[model samples]
Target: MLNKTLVPQSVARKIQGMIQTGEFQSGDKIPSQREFSQQLGVSRASLREALLTLETLGLLETETGRGTFVVGGKPSSSSHMASWRYSDSYSAFDVFQTRIMLEGRITSLAAGRLAASQLDQMENLTQQMEECWARQDLLSNVEADLEFHAIIASSCSNAMLRSLYQMVREQISETQRHPIPITEPARMRASIAEHRRIIAALRAHDGLLAQREMENHILNTARCAGLAP
Candidate 1:
């Protein structure tokens, strides 16, 4: 992300806003690229970029033979924007199930592959999490949580496994903020303790323990974040 740009993010925002605000109803045909470019006061290139992003988001579906149309819209303000949600919020149970399946494999590899610097990085992330918890800041903790998991994901030996973990990290972080249990200090402290346990398991190079601890931690986090039944 540091090496990339968010310049074209605006096009996506406008299109998303239009859909969410009822400006573009589902299944409605959006203006042609040239027409929308003139209406939006943007270059044709920019409009195309925006539409392409919308397509990726599943909000707008484009057909080679037919014109583009709105397939869905963004969720309401009351809903959290899940990384894996397709315009709609994902079911907590389903999300957790997938996380267990996916992160289980990640921890299995990370246990043996974690390097010295990587351990230090994870420790640093843990410290940051503690600081955020002391401040009672959910957003801060979520950011640090993502950093910690990202370090774990990056350490796994397989490139494909690392990529999959990265993708899951997005959804996990996206769901991290404002979970029901985040309102309580006890829940926060428990989370920190669980993190410490997981880190210790990784340090011991116990793959089975590390994997179990990782899975338990994720399930606990999801529950604390109001993402579980």
Candidate 2:
């Protein structure tokens, strides 16, 4: 039965709890709305509401002729390309290529239009990155790293370009989750320094130099992470 006090909580939270407890797993069929209503002592309407909430959050996928399925939650390159009718699977290189195109335009636009305040913002984010690296805060380093790049892209005067970069931001973040081994400390330091240089180029409205520095920074990161030749 539903607790009187806990009833104040949203239905989505209760359903989220069920998923976390492994009441259902990937590819497992969830109970019907009627069954859930009886088990949880809630109305059928409440149970349906909960299911819709879960569906909206990407927790379940429904097929036309079949019931909903609990697809795995782990994100991957192939997972994002499920809608693509490919003769073969997409590769990490495909994603890198797209990033190169997307970020290249963003850097070029940012270079032409960055304001003094935006330069200061990039500098601050880059400084945070250096501190995180020196302290060996690997996760923080990754977050700050992404944020600094994101800040640069967002500062670009072109709204459409900024939106496109934000759309693929999650994919880029996921792909960059590799461990930064301490064996190559110089790579990280050089990457951080390049960020400052790129900011200076943008502040000067030097489009070519800013674009080149930004491209070199990403390529160097890929190489350091052993994702490049």
lDDT of each: 0.67, 0.63
Clashes of each: 1, 0
Give per-residue lDDT, candidate 1, residue 128.
Answer: 87
Give per-residue CA lDDT, model 1, range 115-136, as digits (tens): 8788887888888888865743
Cα RMSD, each candidate: 9.2, 10.5
| Candidate 2 displacement at residue 47 in angstroms | 24
lDDT score, residue 165, model 1?
A: 64
Off by over 4 Å in 2: 1-90, 179-183
TM-score of 2: 0.57
